[model samples]
Target: MGAADSVTACLSKGVGALVGTIIAGSKSFIAKAKILRKTLGSGMRQVGVLCAPALFTLEENKAKILAEGLNKIKGLKVDTASVQTNIVYSDILKSSNITETHLCNILEAHRVLTMPKGPFKLRLVIHHQISESDVKYTLSCIQKAVNGFIG
Candidate 1:
């Protein structure tokens, strides 16, 4: 991954500096990468400045705000253990009668944006800007969306 893609938990496009390090000890790999990079185009500028916010966001949201916030929602099913960092994979209960696309459409209609991963799954990206109240509002909106689709 490029510098920006690794940082910001991949949220801000390619803005921040690189995230992790590669421990490869081969000059062959390095030389090949150097040649390949030309085809990948040039790097970013001022992305170093973006790294500060990206680091802060990753540190802040990853610890407490990710799955803990999402799992509290009422009709949504979240595998709490599967939540590793700032991403939450949401599943709708079969009994809820709401498809992922329908839920996402309803949520978007209510001004709450969501990304659908599959017919039954949604991918939620949590960031530092999302407060506890924001999570509550999201849940509330999801509830409303589900209600709209149910009837």
Candidate 2:
């Protein structure tokens, strides 16, 4: 989209390709990536078997990224079963040693925006604009913030 030389992104994001990524850019960039993939022993054939379920799930539009986020951090209590929509509400446990404002600030530093629902509650609203990779990044940042605050 930009005038950049190359672009690489996780396939498991938005598209739900699961196991691989789509690389697009200059011819030389693609060629070099193929060479690197082969060298790393990542070049594969018939990967469709692993991708079928991902495709079906994407078609059904049933995958929610918040569930993955809810599973990554220990200090946050989120009911995965209750997360049937785009909004995720997390309860910041006292054991985390961090308040809602602290967590929000930490995530904001990483460019991941979040809302403090109350003194100890966090509210995250996911829209179609937010990709799976974005969710993953947010979870990682939250985990780091919690760990940093505790240790």
Report the lDDT tens digits of candidate 1 across residue range 1-151.
4443221134453212235222243577666665765568735466577567766655565524545655665657788787655667888777777788888877787767789998788887665567767777777777667666422
Error of 2 at 104 (Å): 0.4
Instruction: Report lDDT per candidate.
Output: 0.63, 0.72
Stretches > 4 Å off in candidate 1:
1-51, 62-66, 147-151
Report RMSD (Å) for each prediction in the order shown. Answer: 6.6, 12.5
Per-residue error (Å), model 1, residue 10: 5.5
Against the hidden reference, what TM-scores do the models get? 0.58, 0.55
Measured by TM-score, how close is model 1 to the native structure? 0.58
lDDT of 2 at 120: 90
Write one digit per residue (lDDT tens) for candidate 2, span 90-120. 8989987899998888888888788999879
Summed over model 2, clashes come to: 0
Residue pairs of candidate 2 with colliding backbone atoms: none
